[model samples]
Target: MQAVFATTQISERAAAFLPVERTDGFEERRYLDQRQSEYLRMLAELDELLLRNAVQWYQQQGRNADQWLSAVAAARQESRVQSGQGSATRRKSSDVFSRARKLMGERGFPEDQYPPKLVGFTPQQFGLERVARKGLERLKWELERYEPFALSVYSGATREFRTVNAPVRLPVDPLSPGEVEETCILTGGDPFAAGERVRPGVLSAVAGGAVVQLPETVSGRRLALARWIAGADNPLTARSIVNRVWGWHFGRSIAANPNNFGSTGGRPLHPELLDWLAAEFVDSGWSVKSLHRLIMSSRAYRRSSRPADAADVARLDPELRCLSCFPARRLTAEELRDAMLSVSGELNLQVGGIPNRPELHAEVALQPRQVMGSFAAAWVPNPLPAQRHRRSLYALRLRGLPDPGLEVFNLPTPDFSCERRDSSTVTPQVFVQFNSQNSWSRSLAMASRVLRETATEDGAIQQCFRLAFGRSASATELRQCLQHWRDLEAVQREAVFRTPVPPPEVVRDAVEENTGERFQFTEKLYGMDHFVPDLRAEDCDARTRALADVCLVLLNSNEFIYVH
Candidate 1:
């Protein structure tokens, strides 16, 4: 079978564009004694050729004769060091010193004695860089031509050379929008047809083989690829994605680097099990749901997130080589917000549709956004409950606009398909939770729900624990929470209960354009005239107030925010 190479492999040739300085500053005796000396000789010759070319360029431009003589002296000294076979300190300052003296001794008076210099003699600036660039251009041309010929035969004949006919492919520079558009249009290739050959397979003349061009897009490509990759026949892709999923769940993939599966990537700890799961996932109709079920069903996933085995602490298992215990992980950006809304009885579970705008913070919502040429209209949430309440996944994702809260929680940008989400803890997350008005509103709604369900202060506290931790609170926790509720109740009696405020009826603003002009328009809210959820704190008695306290705590705890 003929071997194929990735684009990266071909691109690796560009590394040669960087010139290798032949001045190793060592005597040639070291390399000469060893069979490896021939390599060094060739390298020195290449470097000498580079320097000679530079000198010739300068001489061509009518430079002083001293410049050419100086270059020749320098070359002689370089040759001496490269060829001499003596101790570094003892041997020859003579050959180098003689050259230096000769360079210094030269004093010229006649214009005719001047050495030729390249048209512009600016003091050795950009000379080396220019040479390197020229060398690269020559190399590129040589490689293009060499592909057709330059073959040596075992029958002892001179290498044959043939003219090159390879197509010249210009790279797209991102700085030019026109170039980018052109590339996109050219690469897009017959999008009108469902099954059209977009790119032709490349056939190598020498190799007598071809590289196939696969379809770039397909209706069920992801599903089909998933099936093939996860199947027992394919070991690479299953291990790759599984490790990725593991990384998302535990903040560390079993293979360390999830995407890389070559010899360089860390070997799997439970290789057999990984293969088993990969095969199982494929056998189970490539069902994503089934895969999740198997993973979550494992004893590894269910073990207490807390460290229970103290003596086993010595066996830290730094690499987490075994299925010891469940790893605690921070909730994903979507999960964090979704779980909060779910707990607070405010999550909208409506499925797919054209993305509806959700309520954004006033500071963010009112901010000006730039579209193609002019400022785009400000974001306005759907006024109706069913519309605004849809899942975050299904929300109309703006490429230019990201929810500030979600951003703080490490939500991935929508520009590219994200393989996994990053969970990073930072101070911004703290401010997002405490300072954002959205969090406050959510807390209040949760508080009210708890107060309505559990009348007494103690009962409200227990309910808070139940809602947040999914279990009843201990006696001590209940006592502490009861005290907190009693204090809150006194405060609530003096201060009236608040109702959920209605969304804005209309937002009027001048839209700014990229050209710096503004246009005025009033964006109407569809259902703003309807009754809004009332935040009527006064309507509820002390009992309902207590449940609100429970709800508030439940919404605030780490238990509510993390997934183990």
Candidate 2:
């Protein structure tokens, strides 16, 4: 998982495990979490083993659970001494030690449970020991080496926090990981055991500053937020979302990167028009359909993809900065698969429902995938046409099991939201398009479709062009295809083809992890035993075969793939 904080405040759930203070460095000096540290502590003493670097790697530099906890102790001790309570300092430390020890005790782990690599020392004692063993120069050098990672984690924490708190200010220990000592102090049943708890009001204060005001009522709140977001006064929300919709539909946004609108991002070619649309969206009460209508209705949208002036296109608008002509775009990963099925007269346009499992690679189908605490079952594609050919968006089984074919075309991973998809052409994409079973099947299906649409071979040829290219074949194109078909007639006569009826398998199954045993079961594949139209090689004649080749070229052409 690539960890990124869109802004700073980490989620409360994350904050619970890694408190805010641990992330924000302390004003005072602090130590490390040695017991969990890979270098110094004995793993046996810990109740649960954490990959030493896992949490540490996530944490901002100069901070750790141990350091934050130590600071909390120091602060508490200072408070105690200030109040003429010097006698309780050691007692407080001992109390913390006891709690730590008790938690370990409850686990009932043997003394040498883990690596049993070394004896133990608390984080502070270990740090001082390190100072002696490695000298100050070595310590400084090591810190420098790990500084970037620490800073990145810290920045990430801050970014996470900012998402919720929005410009929140919590005092930080630049050198410590985020930790909520107050949350931990409750372990003793003393609400104020950690001296003082962070005020809940801190969050409200931060949120109040950044969030736009909304109505108090539920529906009113949503409406008000919508108004604010779509309002002319707001520059980001409407522009961002609309740009995303356009990019999704057309393959590219007016602005190169849809989500990013910062100065660093590519400038919009039609800034005035974009602003006009944004204002119109607000005026229309943020209706998505309205924006779609505006864009799709424009002459700009319908222009031919071919650029008339290639030299001027390269020179005057080298980057295609000006909308000189519509650029043809390939169908998106989802659209490509869906469109192919549709063109083959085999589409099943069902709407939303539970996701179906489209077929996956045999290797990937059997590969083990992990969920929260256990492994998930291998993927099985939808057995029925209706489920399988549902709109690409409704296609099921999207738990990081991206179709390899789709991924080759830049399908986004579902684990996180993708604001915009990248469309870079690469060699692997060509390989997938040319060689994959899916491609071959789709190709043959085109041939069968052409033959079915027209009775005579010549008529079938014309139908193929009309269906595939959205226009009748030109005289020259038809002539060339006729010649190609004569050659292919002999090739098909010698070639053997089969439409494999895949064996049914238990699509969903259960497995016992503890015992390493597998239990299999099946679920209905939806509309089983129904008449299905598959790509059949036997269905096509010589002329239909020629048209299929022409259709294949059209589908593969750059003109059909890109959108202006």
Candidate 2 has a TM-score of 0.55
Each model's number of backbone clashes?
27, 48
In angstroms, give how far residue 361 of model 1 lies from its true place: 0.7
Which candidate number has the best lDDT? 1
TM-score of each: 0.55, 0.55
Question: 484-505 in candidate 2: lDDT tens per residue?
Answer: 7777777766766566554433
lDDT (Cα, 0-100) at 442 in candidate 2: 69
lDDT of each model, Cα atoms only? 0.53, 0.52
- Model 1 alpha-carbon drift over 4 Å, by segment: 1-232, 260-269, 318-323, 496-547
